[model samples]
Target: MPDLNWQKSSFSQQASSCLYLAAAPDGTVKLRESDNPDVILTTAPATLGALIRGIKAGEFDHIRTA
Candidate 1:
């Protein structure tokens, strides 16, 4: 994770400031809010891709309400 470049989601608003990203060197994907960089959640490449697809397909719409 030496050269990892963390990027926030394009959909993240300035107010929310959530960080969502895919990291190289191991192809691991991670999600963490910009306000809290110390706490990161990681997932395998395949699962990460699937979750991204689900989000794009509106499978996580409940998150908006919660």
Candidate 2:
């Protein structure tokens, strides 16, 4: 894939690894982390939205560490 205009996540902390996202020219969504930009993950917008919603609903809370 060519270069994308990645935007940092608003919830990112100044001292923590940040999340970044961008929209590809083909309409698919691109995601990466500030700590590891070389590894990019692509997915459909709807799938990403669903993941966000699931996150908001505590669907993955079981995986949280103390």
Candidate 3:
């Protein structure tokens, strides 16, 4: 984490509430919100790709609207 280059979430325009992402040398993707950098979520690239595809396909809409 200390050596990782954290990047802001493209979906958020404001830096204050933005999310940060990084990739470890081991190839694991990491995510954390700028507001709470202490917490991190790690996942593989393939798994993250699938989740993004699902989101674009509206597979998770019910979780918010229901």
Candidate 4:
């Protein structure tokens, strides 16, 4: 993978802690934390789109952290 242009989400906090996204050359998407760019997660564009839609639909609202 070549250099990626990362963009922070609008919902991200003003603090340094945030997530960034970039579109891969092959049309896939990449995700990583702004504070830790070394660790990255890549996924298909369709999958990422579905996840965003699900989030908008509240599909993950039931998730709880201990």
| Winning candidate number (TM-score) | 3
Model 3 segments more than 4 A misplaced: 63-66
How does model 3 fare in lDDT? 0.87
The candidate maximizing lDDT is 4
The stretch of ten residues in a row with the least summed lDDT in candidate 3 is 57-66
Candidate 3 scores a C-alpha RMSD against the true structure in Å of 2.3
| Residue-level lDDT tens digits of model 1 in 1-66 | 565677875677783577757476666776677777778888888997787799999997774443
Report clash pairs, candidate 3.
Answer: none
The true-versus-predicted C-alpha distance at residue 5 of model 4, in Å, is 1.1
Worst 10 residues of 4 by lDDT: 7-16
Model 1: lDDT to the true structure: 0.74
Overlapping backbone residue pairs in candidate 3 total 0
lDDT of every model, 2 decimals: 0.74, 0.88, 0.87, 0.89
Stretches > 4 Å off in candidate 2: 63-66
The residue-level lDDT of candidate 4 at 17 comes to 91
Give the TM-score comparing model 2 with the true structure, all chains together. Answer: 0.81
Comparison by lDDT, 2 against 3, better one: 2
Give per-residue CA lDDT, model 4, range 1-66, as digits (tens): 798998987888764799899998898899998778899999998999999999999998896879
lDDT of 2 at 48: 98
Which pairs of residues collide in candidate 1?
Answer: none
